[model samples]
Target chain A: MAADKVFKNRIRRKLIQIAAFGFTNCHAGNFITGKLYNGKFKEFCTPGLNCYSCPAATVSCPIGSLLAVTGRADLKVSFYVWGFLLAIGAVLGRAVCGFLCPFGLIQDLLGAIPVHKFRLPKILTYVKYAVLALMVIIIPTVLILATGRTAPLYCKYICPAGMLEGAIPLLLTHESLRDSASVLFWVKLAILLAVIAGSVFVRRFFCKIGCPLGAIYGLLNKVSLYHLTVDRDKCIDCGKCAGCCPMDVDPVKAPRSAECIRCGACKAVCPKGAITIGFGSGRKAAKREGLVDMNVYSRK
Target chain B: MNKRKVIGIVILIAGIALIAAGVFRGELDVILRKAAVVCMECIGLG
Candidate 1:
């Protein structure tokens, strides 16, 4: 794709992200009234980490909904939320993070501020998996089983989206709702600030190291319908794609790496136009052309 | 279809079926009950 086309896609993605946020938080009237929407749509889970406690949020967040069901005394699995997430992941993997997440948009906006940028280490990318396993799943379930007390552990302790969307605005408007303020609120506020600061330097900082939801989507990225492919035949060893990848994915080596959010920045910057990303299999085409795996620049 | 494609399709189908079953089992109600209420913890209240 040409640079101009990439520019158009970038604009289109931003528009889509805005549209997604607006659609999920459709009850704009709730912001003024400072009340959550308690409609039938609340039964359904949104792909992003939208807070149900958010005044304008019409849909339940997938992670929260999952915990709500899973942390029950009966400990029954949440089929609906699970299936919905699986379907979404299977279709496009972490592309949802690229094109739909409201928080991703927030990070992108924050990243636009002119500053000395720093690269977040690849070792830290594995941290989100721990968040999913521990904060989102293991810790909550264990507490519920042991003490018979349930809580949205990740949302309570670490979710910056909740603070931004549900806590801040509601707290500003509903003075009565401020009674719960304590050390926890202060801690959460501090976490939100830290996350915000991190995003200013590293793109999608929370997604890389904090978001349990992204971890789930990342796990399914290998089998997702859409894939990122590099044509070895196009043959210039320039590392432009890897250089442009916000997620630090080496497209030539691991086109379908779990860390890849399918942002398409890599494909856009490839000067040889060697990359094609969509529903079709890039590996099969390479194999059909008798091209082996890209092992030249790839680390063992 | 190849093994990966087949596996993906099977998972997709199984997912849709499970979701439909969840709805029938009133799991949607479970989600609704939790979502409709103003969650204190989610808002960083407690």
Candidate 2:
């Protein structure tokens, strides 16, 4: 029975990895021809942080799309983009971060490399929200509204995912793109290298501290349909669930913590089978049981 | 049938409808034009 369960878990991880790669790089022609794919699919945004500039990307990154709209002088708020983000957040929350994001997958793989792992300070988790507010929303919006100038501050200056997936590939394939590279390119490259190095020591370092998209989705995790649920009756408070959590979320105390990426690592590790990934009224039940603190609920 | 579920469903439907309306109204043209290029600025070329 244990062997069967292990086999099932392996299969599930493999399937999710395959889905993540396929969804992000579905534009086969772009990869073959070494060009960007401009199609109707490009009109839509993917649930994860796949860069639109990626050669094989058929869809847009929601953060990139939001930044693009925010940088426009004529548009104040993109109802479509905001609505899309809210909808995705309300439904899936950070499950998209866990199972869908190509960059998240890369971080996971890098984290899997044999090394001494360290836990990040819980305070560091709040940085992504600041990135969301400053880099993604506030900076671009203020620039467009105040100066009538558009700048995707996050993508141009901050997004390591865009650097790794889009810039690196384009630089390799198109010499014209290489000519355009400047100091900013080196800065982005340095940031990507730092993020990659951090991933080796800390699981999901970028997702935990830097991804504005993850931060946005994390906000909706409390109200999202899909989330982790803990059964207080079955939980022994063994601390195993908290130990296994890559994102540093304590499932027993806050099953639907904003920091939770819904990787199911806790669920897999729970000896009591108290933690579950499901859609239901588990949030309220946890609240009623006093397992969750109302202050933390609202503060996060 | 919880309050959270009800609110989530409503938001989900509204979001889908909004995106659909935007697409029908040709908001996608903006995205199409942007995606067609390599976005040199985005990749830190500028």
Candidate 3:
């Protein structure tokens, strides 16, 4: 059964990677826009984390949109942008990272290049919160106040997403873009390379350590109305769940651990039908796991 | 489908719908034009 789960995960990972590539590379199709739309600019925005500045992006990045909205002097709200993000995040969670984020998919592919991997110290996880507070929130807000126009600080200065989605594609097509490279771009590129290299040793080093989006999604792990639970009595304590967890969460203690990406690794590894996912009462859930005796439930 | 799967399908469908609406409403085209203008202005390409 564990083997079957592993096999399924492998298949799912491949499918997700392919979908991400198709979504990311959809920019390749936008060149037709030049002829179809008669626009002086060759590119249009594709929505998500993709930079519209990238020669390849058929879509725009959400972070960019948020910045653009905040940057605007007009106080009017953008229902479309906010609605789009909520809908995507609520429906998909960080499934975007697992299934459709182009940059994330690239990182996964690069990590697969076969090299020594690294184990992360649990403490470094706090860095993502700081990143979220500073880059996505404080910096953009400050820029909006100062310039009346805000750039995506994370995307421009720190996001490997931009480097992969925008910088790489544009550079390949526009030679001048390469000559204009700033120290900032190279620094981000270095970070991207380091993360890519680190993924070889660490599973989802970026998501685990740095992705503000993932940090946002992780906040909803328990309350997203879907979560994992352990039937402790049924749990043989075989530790198979931890063995299977790519992020190294101990399921018994932290089934709904924010660190858990909800990849279903622990559930698949539980030999005794110990772990189940649902919205349920914790006591009843504990009973199902045999943590509480059936006799105990009956008395109530 | 499971919750995760349901969410996945919904996002894919909604994304397609939003994109289509933007095209049909002509709003997406307008936004694109605006974005292109801004991008060009930023880079001084036009």
Residue A109 displacement (Å), model 1: 0.9
lDDT tens digits, residue span A204-284, model 3: 888888887777666545444446667665677788898767677898888657777666667766766667655453456
Model 1 over residues A105-146: C-alpha lDDT tens digits? 899899878887778888899999999999877888778878
Off by over 4 Å in 2: A1-7, A28-32, A282-300
Q: How many residue pairs clash in each candidate?
A: 0, 0, 11
Per-residue lDDT tens digits for candidate 2, residues B1-46, read: 7677888888889888878766665566776777778888777787
Model 1 Cα displacement at A83 (Å)?
1.5
Of 2 and 3, the candidate ahead on lDDT is: 2
Q: How would you encode candidate 2's per-residue C-alpha lDDT over A215-274 as one tens digit per residue?
A: 988988977899887777667889987887888888888987999988777766766555
Q: Which residues of candidate 1, in runs, are more than 4 Å off?
A: A282-300
Q: Judged by DockQ cut-offs, is candidate 1 incorrect, acceptable, medium or high? A: medium
- Candidate 3: deviation at residue A168, Å? 1.8
In terms of lDDT, model 3 sits at: 0.59
Docking class of 3: incorrect
Error of 3 at A293 (Å): 14
Top model number, lDDT: 1
